[model samples]
Target: MTRRTWPLRAWTLVALAGVLLLSACGEGRQSVLNPSGRDALLLYDLARVMFVGALVLWLLVGGLFVYVTRINPREMSRRLAEGLIVGGGVLFPVVLLGGLLVYSLPLMQAPREADEGLRVHITAEQWWWRVEYELPDGGRVTSANELRLPVGARTGLVLNAHRVIHAFWVPALGGKADMIPGRETYLSLLPEAAGTYRGQCAEFCGASHALMAFETVAMAPADFEAWLAAEAQDAAAPQGEDATRGAQVFAREGCGGCHTVRGTQAVGQVGPDLTHVGSRLSLGAGILGVEAPDFASWIAHTETLKPEVAMPSYDHLPPDDLTALAAYLGGLE
Candidate 1:
């Protein structure tokens, strides 16, 4: 058989062309190599260039082996051995060291300047997210499960954990950052467009860690301001006779032991604040939709959906009582 250099080069070019075509499609949402932030995109480009260069090196070395082995069997003993050593010993280290240097360069540079517009604190708990926003007027508001920010503005996030380790990440916005118990970590992201982004607890904290999800809503500045105002309003309890009965059940049945809703009593910080939960996008830490049947099922039997959850089943309640309670909680908006 004769040595062939054409095949190796052809394959390398084909792979490169495929990558270019994928990039050209602007599949930012689906592309692994596509990056949203300036820092991540810069790093991704450098790494991709290095990867292509490495593939070319591999092809050239492999082609050289084919050349020596086939063209002259007599010289193969010496030439092939020397080629193997030189290629393996010299090229491998150079490629590895080169890649390391390329990846480390950006780490030494100072981080980008912090944007003055938005700042929010995120704290990870056992099975939920605690989000706090620092407003321009020096006031702070805290909520759970859902995060709302001004669209197109650069936002700085400070991450912390109350119990165990967790990772905070929103794939569309940026990469992940660890939430350590005692240490605070910071990440900055700018949502280019206004929409909803889904995120989860990347670290395994406990049994319900997978259920520990959160949602981010990026809205226009005017809309965001309106949302903030609405969230800050005092709680308004349900007024109808059925809703009044439901409120009585909530107080009698020990629902106040874990959750909180402003005014009219029921203040327990162990779980999420239901003061404006009806107005939020989703419920149960984004596990279920905020609809009548979903809420009814979840309140009636949580363990059936998620085994060993902190909240036990309220399965003993009668159907009418369950319906009334669900209606009352739904009216919290």
Candidate 2:
């Protein structure tokens, strides 16, 4: 080989080695192949097989093109034409149907059982998710924008949409499931690891669709039970005159029209159920952190944070009224 060819070949080998190294190092719970749930893993396997098969077919077609055009261009006549026509006509339909069947058969088979699994109903709005869980004794725990699941246990999800169409997808645990308005869709997720996983609304709902996000907290069994019980209990009223004044403002003002807190007179269901608001990690549909200043800004002027939102801005209220409402709402844990 030429001296220059030796260097070029060495660089190509190095580049290929780097790519292999990167592929080897790519490992995570959210990875398509290293899935945390059973159905997700099965789907991953099907996609992988189809991907590899398609790549091989593409390589074969490329080689065929090169051979037909270069080495056999003079001899490519009636026989070659017939071979190309027959091969082209027969290959695509068979490959596509085979791939479709291989990918869809698992979904068509007998559904996986989740007899003892926890059941949660998830409703997706334009840019947020409202999650409700039913306990064993017929009681329930409702939260917004966050989902808590028990690690190593099968969890069944009943999904729907309140306003527009949206898709629920938590890459760590499963695939995308559509939440259609007025119809219920079911999916099962078994989280084997304990961590906060990011989830997003996969469908284009509205302007804030890019910001439509949620978090899945996979806790230990004991911790999950404790959280469930805590969420199910009635919300405690805040103590002291300042807190009392805040509560009065929360009730007197129109904030009670959309939000809810158990044991309080605010039982509106049009928005999130904030029974344990203070204990939650974030607020404003996970757009704002749970903090004093963030709460103040959001409650004062929600329209600024989300343009054209259904909820109106309370910026017209008096400064004291805004402060009192913020304090009271922030204390509902």
Candidate 3:
């Protein structure tokens, strides 16, 4: 009735549960532990080393406490106490941390852009991204809230912020880079596999900072080239009577003043390039889906969905007109 201890199997089950919980946290595209690139792999390796060292230190100190309190219940000799305090407390951590610092210095070096390789210029807006690809042939193609890259290639990203400072981070790909106004920073990622990942603005900039995210898609080189070619084209004409009516609404409502649809006289550059918004994987900078309902919701609830957003709500429009407008935007693909 004095004390109780868990059975070995019970302890084992608890440990297993803890491991499963930790693994679940690292299972998604936004996790650094689920590394798909060279730089992320380096970071994962460093994390493993540090975790193991901390575990070992905890075990050593706990073991010494258990021995002194439960087993012997006696004071240690002066020499043993001094040695334990000096060696285990001082020498071990210094050597381990010094080695870690030496190992991480090279990994922290500035990214180098290889001549003739891929280069992308990214500008961080209040709650979105402006992505421009500098093609090898000296042409520029623009997109928004989505980044595409080729597998097994080192892509150089030139980054800057529009107003406040933001941080560009794709945890599965690499570390964070600060985006300062009027100053260009750089980050390089060498993707080792073809997959979709999530990137976010790591620094706190404004009210919608947490909602500011994007998608990173890594594809085969051929597929990436084909996609780029398609993205370079202007938007297709709106189809059907409802879509046509919606296009008229788009014009009459003066949506063209802020957005550029790239083909039919909607060339304004104050906001994201919606040249192919209908075909994008997501909307509202990865916060909404690409379906018609999603489009309507974003248009109708701009501030409610994304606080302090620059785009005004179009809720005043009639429901039929809204549906038509959504359909027209969807057909831009």
Candidate 4:
């Protein structure tokens, strides 16, 4: 092929490869492309259209550049050149961008009405999320790390920051909203399907910002109601001797000063609530699975897993005691 043709071909191939790579990147549970909510789907559609339009514009500009540089300039007319400059450079962008704005502005306002939706409050901390659900009767349920929504229902999230600025983003559910300290912001999500999605802190906050993630579970309306009811209740008593011993160990080690477990003396609010810890899909802000070994590791060497976390390491505890503690936390469901 000629050199001129080669450049176009190479550019095309690179653009195609980039698009494919981006498409592959969206297969994760937290992908905007794999949208599960009304707002997210709308945003995805807008993005795809904008991307295609941009690609076409890029090719047109590139082709014009190649034609001008590689061909005889004397063969071009002044009228054609001026038309290309004005139409392509000015009119095209104006029309395209103006149309896009008009199309997307309505979508930005299309989330379900918040007054009729389930109200949830999300407080962003340095590396974790504090979640609270407000019932229709004005009662509230508190949870940490995991957000559960009912499928086919509109949920309103009130965002606030306890320590630093953060952004609450569940890519599959909807667009992100910022969490500013002393300021309450809002976002609305309407889950259209029943499945599990992942969410994360879209804004950097601290040393473990990348690890500040959570799980979003969308369930049937009835199931969600039952789950909410269960969450509202205090944690059940430990059933086994190991768990009982572990609870004793937790209390003796001053773990209560940081974490909270309902129906127990551990009511400190310095860390995530552990009321239904065993039922959560992940632990330590989605860093690890809810397993005994992982729990033990987190307790023993928190700094090793998440550097500069507020929780101190419990590595000095006896091995058996650590095991018991892990077992106890694991059974918190």
Best by lDDT: 4
The list of candidate 1 runs beyond 4 A from truth reads: 1-54, 57-114
Question: lDDT by residue for model 1 over 1-333, one digit each (tens)?
Answer: 124565566767988998898767654442335454444455556667667677667676665655666544454477868777886669775877687687767653422345677788888987788887887788866688988877667778888999789998776666678999999888877665677777778888888888888887878889998888877776786879777787788888888888887786788878778877777777778888877677789888787766556787889988888887877887788
Better of 1 and 2 by TM-score: 2
Which candidate model has the greater TM-score, 1 or 3?
3
Model 4 lDDT tens row, 1-333: 986578777887997998898776856789887899998999999898888878777878877777777754456688998998999899988887788788878888866346577899999987888999998898878899999999997888988998789998999999988999999998889999899999999998888999999999999999999999999889878878889999999999999898889999999999999989999999999999999998999999898898888898999999999999999999988
Q: How many residue pairs clash in each candidate?
A: 0, 0, 0, 0
lDDT of every predicted structure (CA atoms)? 0.75, 0.77, 0.88, 0.89
Candidate 4 residues lying further than 4 Å off, grouped into runs, are 1-4, 75-80
Model 1 lDDT-worst window of ten = 27-36
Instruction: For each candidate, give its TM-score against the true structure.
Output: 0.78, 0.83, 0.88, 0.93
lDDT per residue as tens, model 3, 67-133: 6665557878999989988887888778877887897777666344443579999999989999999
Worst 10 residues of 3 by lDDT: 1-10
lDDT, model 4, position 283: 92
Identify the runs in model 2 with alpha carbons over 4 angstroms from their true place.
1-34, 88-100, 107-116, 239-242, 318-321
